[model samples]
Target: MPATLPLDLFLGALVTVGLLAYLTYALVRPERF
Candidate 1:
């Protein structure tokens, strides 16, 4: 149970980063991604 907490946090962080990166790319290119 304790290990799952860290795992969920890590995955959430990764998703946040990925979403931010995708948004940045979309803003910069507007059509490529």
Candidate 2:
């Protein structure tokens, strides 16, 4: 099934932000990054 443009964009943005937050947290600790 094909996702609508808006739906795809929203999901993409959501995932991107989630990964970004995770990466930011991981990077914050020098030993963890």
Candidate 3:
């Protein structure tokens, strides 16, 4: 169980970054996407 901790944290960070990028893109270009 301890070995999976890093993987979980990495995934969470990845997801958060992805969501932020998507939101930024949508906000910057509402007509393109």
Using lDDT as the measure, which candidate wins? Answer: 3
lDDT per residue as tens, model 2, 1-33: 556568788999999999999988888976975
Give candidate 3 misplaced runs (Cα > 4 Å): 1-5
lDDT (Cα, tens digit) per residue for candidate 1, span 1-33: 464668788999999999999999899998785
Model 3 lDDT tens row, 1-33: 465668788999999999999999999999997
Please, what is the whole-model Cα lDDT of each candidate in the order they appear?
0.88, 0.86, 0.91
RMSD of 3: 3.4
Q: TM-score of each candidate?
A: 0.76, 0.64, 0.77
Tell me the lDDT of candidate 3.
0.91
Stretches of candidate 2 exceeding 4 Å from the true structure = 1-5, 30-33
**Model 1 TM-score relative to the real fold:** 0.76
